[model samples]
Target: MLPRFLERLRQQADNLAGLLGNRVALFGIELQEESERLLGHLALLLGAAICTLFCLLSAVVAGLVLAARYGVLLEVCATLAVLFLLLALGLAWYLRRRLADAPEPFEATRQEFERDRLALNGARETAQ
Candidate 1:
């Protein structure tokens, strides 16, 4: 009877180990998924930014050419350039603030880990 009991206990331990391993693997997969999503979003944003920059440059050039016909090309171009720079700076600052305010990544995984720790502790105490 004691031998059978020991065998059952060992089997339970193995099952617990496997469960823990699976949970860790799940956490890793979730982390990877979130990282890939963030990277994809960054890439898309970069592409859009490049396209917007090209458009802005073309518009500025066209505006300058039109102003030349009106005899104030230099002044108009300078003012437009300064305005665009200030706008870009303002947007960059705002984006920085928004990113800083964003929640920590992998929050779900963190919560799951905490719950698992508490559960394991409770189990251990009960067993003792």
Candidate 2:
């Protein structure tokens, strides 16, 4: 009887360990997914920034060449430069606002943690 009881206890310990391992694996998977998503967004933003920079540079060069060919180069270039500067500032401000409005990442994980805490507190209260 003692040996059988010891075997059963060992079996239960192994099962508990397995359960914990599975939970850890699942948590790791969730973290990986979130990290991948963040990286993807970062990559896209970087690509967009590179493209916009190229476009802005092209536009400025084109504007300056046209102004030099058709009008007073210095005055036209100054005006174009100021216009582009203002446009860049406006876009930066808009991006700031948009970023502020963006949702928090890993919100689901936070909510799940809160729910678990509440449930544990409720269980503790019931026990008391």
Candidate 3:
């Protein structure tokens, strides 16, 4: 009877493990999806910034050439500064998005640790 009871307990634990495994798998997929989304957003934003920067730089160079010939060096310098500011802002925005979308590995580990600790405590209490 004691062996049968232990077998039943094992079966129950296996079932619980299966259920937990399914939940973890689902959550892992969700995390992967979120990570992919965050990466995609970053890639798109970076690509756009690169293209815009190249276009702006080319335009600035052309402007500088014209300005040098026309004695408008001050305006050229101001325009270049604004372009740099815009690029800096774009980079900051991308960084913010990446940070916001980052996953916390600690949460998952904490939950698993708590479950194991509880199991260990219950076993000790029952044995005592």
In the order shown, what is each candidate's alpha-carbon RMSD?
3.0, 4.5, 3.9
lDDT against the true structure, per candidate, is: 0.81, 0.75, 0.79
Clashing pairs for predicted structure model 1, backbone only: none
Q: Which stretches of candidate 1 lie over 4 Å from their true place?
A: 1-9, 86-103
lDDT of 3 by residue, 79-99 (tens): 888978987897788778777
TM-score of each: 0.72, 0.61, 0.65
Q: Look at candidate 2 and tell me the lDDT of residue 80.
A: 71
TM-score for model 1?
Answer: 0.72
1-128 per-residue lDDT for model 2 (tens digits): 99999998899689667755765666677788868866876786687678878887898888878887988789877887787788778767866776677666656556656775687589669979
lDDT of 1 by residue, 1-128 (tens): 99999998999899789877877887888889778867876886697689868988898988988898899988888888888898688768866776687667777677877887898899889989
Which scores higher on TM-score, 1 or 3? Answer: 1
| Backbone clash total, candidate 2 | 0
**Order of quality (lDDT):** 1, 3, 2
* Candidate 2 residue pairs that clash: none
